[model samples]
Target: MKFNIKNRVTLLVSVWMMSFTMNMLEGVCSIPSSLEVFEHHKNVTGKKWAVLVAGSNGYENYRHQADVCHAYQILKRGGLEDDNIIVFMYDDIAHHPKNPRPGIIINEPNGSNVYDGVPKDYTGEATNAQNFYAVISGNRSALSGGSGKVVDSGPNDTIFIYYSDHGSTGLVSMPEGDDIMANDFMDVLMEKHATNSYKKMVIYLEACESGSMFEGILPNNINIYATTASKASEDSWAFYCPDYGLPPPPEYTTCLGDLYSISWLEDSDKNDMTKETLQQQYQIVRRRTLIGYKDFHSHVMKYGDDKLKNDLLANYIGANPSLDENAYSFEPSTTQTRLVNQRDAHLLHLRLELQMAPEGSKEKLKARQELVDEISHREHVDNTFHLIWDLLRDKNNNSTMMLNVRPPGKPLVDDWDCFRTLIKTYENHCGRLSSYGKKYTRVFANMCNAGIYVEQLKATTSQVSIPLTSSSTQTLDLSSIGSSFPTSATLQELELVTSIDEELLQEYGDELHRFGKVQRVFVVSLKDRSSHMLAMTTSFLKGDYQDELRFFRVHKSDVYESQVAVTKGIGKYDVANGYAEIKVVDKVGFSTKGGKVTNSKFLLFHIYLS
Candidate 1:
């Protein structure tokens, strides 16, 4: 059946950022006071285990129920059985929109059909490698004494865990009624008397201001990964809470909690993607995750606490060094103010690398507990914190003042040919970084029109390598979504609002508005690695879709802010070097006008159609 065209009002895309107050005690100490030994690669292998801990009580305030389910399913699919996992549930409906189960599904349901059956926890089987799974299905009062397999599980397991809820400073609040300080979790694992039990543990924590617990405490026997850098409540609104509300209520839309997990899993996958490729995907995933959350924040800010950390980032470095090797070079004095003797500099760097491990929190465990203090005292470590043995000890070497130098690998890649490739790759992996490690900036408007497209969004091909630092702009084509949605005037209006020229402005604006007339439209703003939904208007509007409208999205590698910010600053739209992305929707139909001339109910007079 043919339908009439109607345009509705709607916000096109939603953009938000998370501000965090992270506890960075380890980041400060791990600055590498000397130099690193990257030339000589190292590897530590052992049985791997993953665990997911979820507290889904308040769905309205800290809604992360989907994340809980996603974590469980992924773990099970990855070969983790009932024996190696655990889930904790609270009686109250605080974390989840409504009370929910730990894993949304069971490994093997009682019924023959997979989707037809119910979901269950992983506590049925007992595995060979001491692998186990436990779940605390409701309330925090039970958590204190509820040390299921988590306490008994060895430190060596590759535990990928998550805590989704409200957090202040170092404390992660439990529905049990009180907050569990971040330091408490670290104390459980970092203190040699306790943490030494595990061999290699990796903790992926999700909460607010989680970075605070990291102060002074270095991860040991485990790898520590966090969502943000500092304690920031205002950031969450920008991070996940919608500015207005989600899917406009009665329409609970999806959130961004699983984005990071997806990227992490994909990046680590040995299948079609390499570690390098996966890392690149992380930035995209991270940005997309933020976008989803931003839409959420925009949808639900006024209804609840607006103070929120709207973003997530890797606050801890817990990866173990894969190799150790070095190549020597002495070129001087430009970037650094003071120039030192080439020979002394080389020696200084060598001294520093001797004591420290390059990556991973597993090896750092020994260092954090003073188990290596005996070795540290007798050795003369270089600026990089490398500990030297008795024979090489130099009392005069400065440990506090020295800087950590990275051992030589490949040629210096400051120039674009090499540097751009690497940074761009990082962006592809983490989505937060440009292929190189630069922050992305948004210019002009929310979308960019590269050219007049039809069927596919193809742009004028230019630079092959990303991470390029140059001021350039390209046109995008339209016609894929429709051909007759918005009229010329509507297109002009859209272009003017979005900031396009008069000539092409009207054409683009009308086109966008035409798409905006659909029953419901999903608008995507690709800015700074984040793919956010700008609009979810049930009744689309004529002015919403712009055929050739232009806007830009912020996407980059701030991995810090470069990882999530839409652009550096507001206003200033310098065309130097920037990129933008957008997605639009709409509906249209013919219109006719007629009059009942005879008034007999059955008699119809002249009909006018335009």
Candidate 2:
């Protein structure tokens, strides 16, 4: 970047300004000046890269040498520094051994052209699989190793684990059975970076049947994404069929080496895209690869059975918090499992059935709600199923996950009195959404802790527990353990949907007092275009605690003209998920358009407990 002094000064100002704003809005109202650590970014550490590759040179390899060449193009693209890169490949005839395909060659105006292939053992036959592995592990002689070096880690790094290989249903093997343990490789990858503090890790796999690799992957601190080839067996043949490359080059089956690789990674037509952009583009191709493979397979089979296909699909995908294909792969013993969730709704079939039973016909409404509440609150617990999937997802695929929720399953149900009486009790104890975000940290912490409680419920019920000797001992109550979990921090913003009712605010206000001191409540009325924003203090909401609360008001003009209410003070922090429940009141306060009011849309409320 050849920047003039003017440009450098502008960047400094921009970075400083944005940092200041973020700190202030997040309630960091004070910052010390003249810290020695503020300057000297030169002291910050650099980064590193990790790469993996496997190649073949039989009939397909003979025809797709362009693929080998493409790998070089990817290495040279963007700002990927040379010292940081590691390349694993089987790009020459010796590694190709039997039959060698001519590899592709790329020339960067300012970069090294790296696809020069070596001679010997030349033929049209595919390379022996052993050479491929040997080449990657650095077992070859001088001038006979990888396209790049072997790198494991760095202070703050960016790792790229890429592959282009041939595969079958569950394995990538050479005709001679030289396949590495796919699961083992994934485990090693994640284990290598167990602490997961890298800036990001990118896994770009180009192989047949590669899509299935998503199973059993666990990431450390990296984001794991792969081409649909991860599931189905796929070849990177440059032109075996008419419908393969991006936009299906009219007559291709195997994806050739140089096409997607060179164009996207190396010579991307979009100059504006950076290394970061290239990483994201990999996702687009990964999904498209899956749909493409499925389509190709379907075209070959000619089977239009939706149910059969869905069952076949269920053979692979799952959400047990582990490998989907593994858990859902097996049919549950009972018909209950099959019929219970056919509609794809979040409702738990057993609980819903009990709920709809006569309010008196079943074991009583209390018993039914207890059962419903248990399942609805599944998010708070970690069950065997969660454990199962976590163990099975391909370690590479789950590296740095961003979704903030328990693995999706039972707790996926909606929260309401229908599920938990505590919800109702808490509301009645406080008021309504009023105590939301104010004491939010405390409130949600208990809710999160409640999840800990449910796990105890399951633990006590586990069949493997040894019976304790009893003389004159009291029976243990598992619920007591449930109450021992942690409390989370308060969220800065808690805007409820416009539909929530305003009248319930007071009750929520009271319930939230459990977390910490209640400060203030900011409610914008949904009823009228001119509805004034209400600032309720602790004294106004809680008659007894009024004396303990401190209140401050800023001029109307001083408040930012934004709907997001910023929480202040030391306890403010982010939550695992949006800990506060969001509801759309049956009324509308504002229309879909931001303008005009009269009908109720919803209200915003947040809660934070200590």
Tens digit of lDDT per residue, candidate 2, span 461-501? 23111212222312222233222111211121133222221
State residue 353's C-alpha deviation in candidate 2, in Å.
66
Where does candidate 1 stray beyond 4 Å? 1-45, 91-147, 192-195, 219-234, 237-250, 253-610
Best model number under lDDT: 2
The clash number for model 2 is 99
RMSD of model 2, in Å? 30.3
Clashes of each: 191, 99
**Which one is best on TM-score?**
2
Show the lowest summed lDDT stretch of 10 residues, model 1: 598-607
Q: Please provide, for model 1 over 1-610, each residue's C-alpha lDDT reduced to its tens digit, 9 standing for 90 to 100.
A: 0111111011001100110112143343222210121111112223334455443343332234334444554454434554555554342222233223332221111101111211333222221112211121112233333334443444443444555444433244454432344434544544422544434343544443334334334432233333331222211221112112221122222232322333343333222221122124334445533444323211111101111111111101122222112211112213312211211222222222223423446544443223222222212112011211111123323332112221222111112122233223323322322100111111000011111111111111111112223223323333222222324323233221221111111113112112222112222223343323221111113334321221222222211111111121112222212222221100011111252111000000111111
The lDDT per prediction is 0.27, 0.31
Relative to the true structure, candidate 1 has a C-alpha RMSD (angstroms) of 30.7
Error of 2 at 98 (Å): 13
lDDT of 1 at 597: 13
TM-score of each: 0.32, 0.33
